[model samples]
Target: MEWIKLIGILIILVGFIFKFDTIAVVIIAAFTTALVSGISITEFFTLLGEAFVKNRIVTIFLLTLPMIGISERFGLRQQAVILIEKMKGLTTGRFITLYALIRQLAGLFGIRLSAQPQFVRPIVNPMAQAAANARYGKISEADEEIIKAKSAANENFANFFAQNTFAASAGVLLISGTLTSLGYEVQATSIVLVALIIAGISFVLIAIDNFLFDLKMDRKYGKKSSKGGQKS
Candidate 1:
């Protein structure tokens, strides 16, 4: 029975090697592990239900796939390019930094709009790329990939660090509950206060990183622009 537990790991390895659907493979592997550990099938369903309730927002995010597809099919990226081209003062770096600021502020207020794939990838990334293209003409494939990564990173840093600043946030509640269970007697207020300070520091650091990365891109573009001028 004990050795049978390893079968779940083997299943995952095989599934990955064969390039199977990752979500299906992982869920099946989890169920197999629970059953091998002597958990009843009914208990497994109960666990799944509880997890779904706790993270139903993520489920909703997944459901937005069709909506994203429809929007993109209707020239979502083209609209972003047009809008970004009209904004003279908004460079790629400034745009990402501004988004980070808004994301952190929204998280503090419990609004939580820092979704990368849904919001960033579809909308924000295209706009940032447009801004870069406006300034640099046409960038290399590698530079565009790096800019997208930086945009995603800014979203992640803002969302993760700022959400904890809310006293009644799920993260604070979970932390308080865990500490209570461990007999630590931690207060939610304390967690929120510390989280607030951390959020401030994170915003500053990420802003700096965005600024520096933008400078690097600027230098690259500057070189390209000078070379083009010399050729003309």
Candidate 2:
């Protein structure tokens, strides 16, 4: 019986690895495991119901999908582009870097900052493109796409790396709890201070990376202009 349950779990893992529908895999695994364990269908369903009740927050967020979809249908991208175009003297890298900083700051307060359809697809991507065009006179299609991807990645990295700095952050709390459970006296503030030091280092590294990339692009553009002038 235990072996059957283990086999059911293995099947679910395999299904996931093969990119099968997650819901179907979960349902199949649950049914198979219940059958092997001699659990009646009604009891299995009751257990599932209890699990769902325990995770009601997840269901509430899933319910918000339709409202978010409706809002996206109403000129969200166009509005973002227009707003970005109004800002002068912004470069793609600078614009994205500023957003990254804002995202990190917001994470400290446990605000959920989404990238797709909210930050990246709607705002940051368009803003980065507009900034690129403003700086380079005319950005190519490929460069515009690159800017969008970079902006999204920047937001992800910034938010993930900075959250560790907050004393009450989920990661810090999780670590502190684990240590306490293991009979070790750990301070959340000490963990947070260490996380802050690491976050600061990460910020500096990201900034330096952006700066170097911008410098390289400027040099490449300067070379191209010089060549064009020589030809003229």
Candidate 3:
């Protein structure tokens, strides 16, 4: 029945509204569509296998997860703190702002290596704290949490707004593919181009906010000497 064609969408709406398991909802949606379209069971599985092989890139992040975990366990984060402590004139806000810029730039090329779970919390957040200590001499727990929270927000805003600019990015590809299949005939480049304004504005606004916060910190602690302190 033509009415059955709407079942996939209905399942999605209800599944999300009820907060059901997302993966199971997607599987059910696909089955509902196949069944309504009179697809034989054998053909449905064959098509599913072909689709999986075509887009196995979705599993690439899982391959890198274990190595990231191992690196953290072996003192990779401690090394980051030591390196950051050695850099003179790098304040808490300056370090976080620079990180956001680097992450945003990498997003243009579809690189997301500095994400929060694997990199920022373990590595970047600690580095920011080291820089703060170098500048302020000592910071309270509350102030440290403030810096870390800002660092996390910086990474999230920069990465979330900028990554869509990469035409070949997985998110962009998925969106464009969905639209194309629905007969919209849109190009990924157009989407990326439109997103550029949003990304650029976000980078500039967040950078300014960060540097201004550093000015506030400078007043809280005595301003640094012109020598930028001894290197290492």
Q: Candidate 3 regions off by >4 Å?
A: 1-69, 174-185, 224-232
Candidate 2 colliding pairs, count = 0
lDDT of each: 0.85, 0.73, 0.86
Instruction: Report backbone clashes per prediction.
Output: 0, 0, 0
Pairs that clash in candidate 3: none
In the range 1-232, model 3's lDDT, one tens digit per residue, is: 6989889999999999999999899889888888898998888889989998999988777866787789888998889989998898888888898888898889998886748777788888999999988776677898899988998899899999998989999988999999999999989998899778889999889989998999888776765455645222
Clash-forming residue pairs, model 2 = none
| Residue clash pairs of candidate 1 | none
lDDT of 1: 0.85
**Highest TM-score model number:** 2
lDDT of 2 at 109: 65
> What lDDT score goes with residue 184 in model 2?
95
lDDT of 2 by residue, 44-66 (tens): 99999999999988767655566
Ranking by TM-score: 2, 1, 3
Q: How far is 66's C-alpha from truth in model 1 (Å)?
A: 0.7
- Model 1: per-residue lDDT, tens digit, 94-181? 9998888889888888896637767899988998998888777788999899888988888999999999888889999999999999
How high is each candidate's TM-score?
0.75, 0.80, 0.66
Candidate 2 at 87: error in angstroms? 0.8
